[model samples]
Structures are given as structure tokens and as C-alpha cells.
Target: MRAIILSGAGRYADPWHPYAETSARLAELVAAAGYDVEVRDDVDAALAALRDDVDLVVVNAGDPDGPVPDGVEADAQVEVDDTALAAAMDRGIGVLAMHASASSLRDYPAFDHAIGARWEPEVSWHPPFGEARVHLVGTHAVCEGLDDFTVEDERYANLRLLEVIEPIAEHEEGGVRHPLVWAREFGRSRLVYDALGHDARSYDSAGHRALLARALEWLSHVPAPTADDRRGAAGPTSAT
Candidate 1:
């Protein structure tokens, strides 16, 4: 299988995150999952490159609408068309969104729905980065048979969910359990959003690696059902 990783750069780059380093780690993980991986720093270009042969698109990017810090020259505003990406998903491409990617690509209005979630600024925030225990919350092939595990990373708290998603993992903060991982289907596309991977350390966890590997394995073969195909079930399936 083939995978294209959209690594953050230019206007999508942020001061707080090490996008390049973490994207390199993600490339290694994706490659180990049996995919021929290519990493691209340009978000729009990568999306434009989406084709029938690309099985997966890993979004490891920063928010384009976010605040820009000092010393970083913002890239000129470039025209972005979501037509290619939307068409690709309509054709059953799998999406693996990581961390702050929940907030990336805001220029594409449907980007949040495509990933099944969004990071609402001010409303959504995280505490200091530290060791966190992630708990499995539901039954899904991506997380099946996996136990809760700890990792050194940022816990994305209170992200706004945009779709009916099955949350498969969570973490507690101040007695409130917040979802850290979820899986859902958008049209014919299968999507998984993981709110971990703040840095390379987060990817260093054996458990985290295992979870991501399972995600890749599932993404490589599964075709999520469209809305019409989900109507008569007991409840919405994870892929619906």
C-alpha cells in the first residue's frame, strides 16, 4: 500500500510543535506498517497529489488559522482547492489525522467533518505535556485487544466532535474523561483521529506504536459504509 504524509510547513507550521521531527517518526511507523511512504511539507500540494493509488493520507499538520509567533515568516496565502481531497475520500481513501490536525486545513470548510472532529480554540485546550495514561473506551478493530497505555505527550482536552463517532480511547483530567482517539466514516472514507503525537517521544511508546500499526493495518483494507448503508443497524457502526 502507499501512504502520503502531509507534514506541516509555511503558514501551517507552528512554534510550539516539532512538526518535521514528529512527521519523520510517523513516516517510520507508517513505513513499518508495510506502506511505501512519502512525506511532503506542503499541505495543499500533498492534497492535490491525492490519487487512486494513494491508499492513505496522514495529516500531521498544524492549524493554518492559528496564531503566528514572532520570528516565523508566514507563507503567502495560496489558493487551496478541496475538490481533489473530497473526491479522493468519495473514492474510499483512508485518513489518519494526528494531534493538532484536528484544527488544520480550516480553509477547506468540510475538513473537520472529513476527519470527524475539530479543535475549537479557547474552548479546547491541553495542560502541560507530561506522562499520560490513555484508556481504551470502545470496541473497534483499530483498537481491539489493546490495553490502556501511558505515553509522554499532550492530552488534547475538550475537542469538539463534529460527527457521530465511536471513541475508542480516552484520558481523564480533573475527573473528566476526554476522548483521545476515535474512528468514524465520512461518506465512503474511513477516518481515525488520534489526539496524541505531540512529539517524537509520544511515538516512542511501544503501546502507541502498536495502536498506530493496528490503525494502518485496518485502514489498508477496510471500506467504510456510506450514510445510506448505515440506516438499519442497531446503532451506528464505527465505520458508519
Candidate 2:
């Protein structure tokens, strides 16, 4: 198995801070899952390399609007090409959309549709740090071994959820319930989005890590890790 990580934009721009560290740590965890994981900080390069051999694609949200960097451009066609590749890969592959990734491709309809939601300005984080209770609502393999649990970190609001979705987690705040994690199928492809991973702590949380790992495994159809796989499992280290 092989996974490609795109970690070079939106809130992830660099001095190699927490976001970068979290991405690296996530890649390491993917590697530990018995897959050859390749991480590219350049969105264009990452997209270009998405042909075959890559079993999964992980896209990190990057800078909101500071130019598309060296490899990536502001071209919609490029975005469409990338989305098409991802969708094709999804026939039997996996795609993980992290934190701001939901908010990353506003201009690309294919990407927005594939993700099952488009980020709106109204969508913002609730409290920089707090314990959010997430309720599981899906029966997919990704939710296997996962129960309703709480994570200490940021929560998102005002997401425009598309019609196609199998919600896996929900959160109620101020008496309003919202979907926190969900899975959707797009033309034979499996797409999972978690509105968490906003910080290092959230990514490293045991519950969150397990959910992420399971999501990847489910999308790739890899056998769920058994007790033996967990024996020497190394959780992500601090990216600070």
C-alpha cells in the first residue's frame, strides 16, 4: 500500500510548525500500517504523482489565498485533473480529507462534490481547546472498534453537508447537533472526512488516532489491525 500526503497550504504554510509536524507524524503512522507512504509538501507535485501505485491520498489544508505556490496554480483545470485522478483512484483506493482540507478547494466543483461539503466563511472553529463528545452514527468498517468518544481540541461549525453521506460522528453544542465525521461513496470510490485534526493534540489523541487509522484501513480494504499490530504501535510524537 502507498499513500500520498499533500501538506503545503492553508494554515499549514511554513516555518514547519504544528501542522507540518502533525502531517509528518500522520505519514509515519500510515507507514506503520504496512504501507509505503510518500509525503509531498507541494500540492502540484502531489497531484501529479497520483496516477497509480498510490493506494491513498491525504490532502492537508494550506494557505487560504497567498498564491498557489511553485507547483500548484490557481487554474481550475488543474484542480479538476487532480480531482479526476483522485476519483479514479477511489475505484479501489482511499482518500483522507483533514482539517482545512474541506475548505481547500472552494473553486473546484468536482472536488467539492467529492468531499460532500464545501467550506463556507461562516464555518469557524469553536473554542481553541475543549473536550468535544463525538457520537458514531455509521456502520462502516472505519467505525469498527470506535465508539462515541471525546477529543480535546477544536471543533468546526457551519459546514454545508452535501446530500451524499453516511455520518459516522455527530456533536451537539448549544443544543444544535452537527455531523463531525462521515463517509460517502462517489462512483465506486470511498471518501471519509473528519472535521477534527485541527491541532497536534487532536491528531495524537488515542481515539482520534484509532479513528484515522481505521478510516484508512477501511478505504483501502486492508484487514483491520489485530492485537499483534497494536503491540508495537507507536502513536504520533509531538510535532512541536
Q: TM-scores of all models?
A: 0.91, 0.77
Tens-place lDDT per residue, model 1, 1-240, is 889999888778988888999999999989998899999987887786677788889999898867655676766668888887887777888889999898898887556667777899889999899999999887799888798899999999988877788888999999999999988776677888999999999998998999998888887764566667668555756864
Clashing pairs in 2: 9-62, 9-63, 10-62, 10-63
Task: Work out how many backbone clashes candidate 2 has.
Answer: 4
Local error of candidate 2 at 195, Å? Answer: 0.8
lDDT tens string, model 2, 137-164? 7677678778777888667776876667
Over 4 Å off, model 1: 69-71, 225-240
Q: How high is the lDDT of residue 117 in model 1?
A: 72
CA lDDT of each candidate? Answer: 0.85, 0.68
- Determine which window of 10 residues in candidate 2 has minimal summed lDDT: 9-18
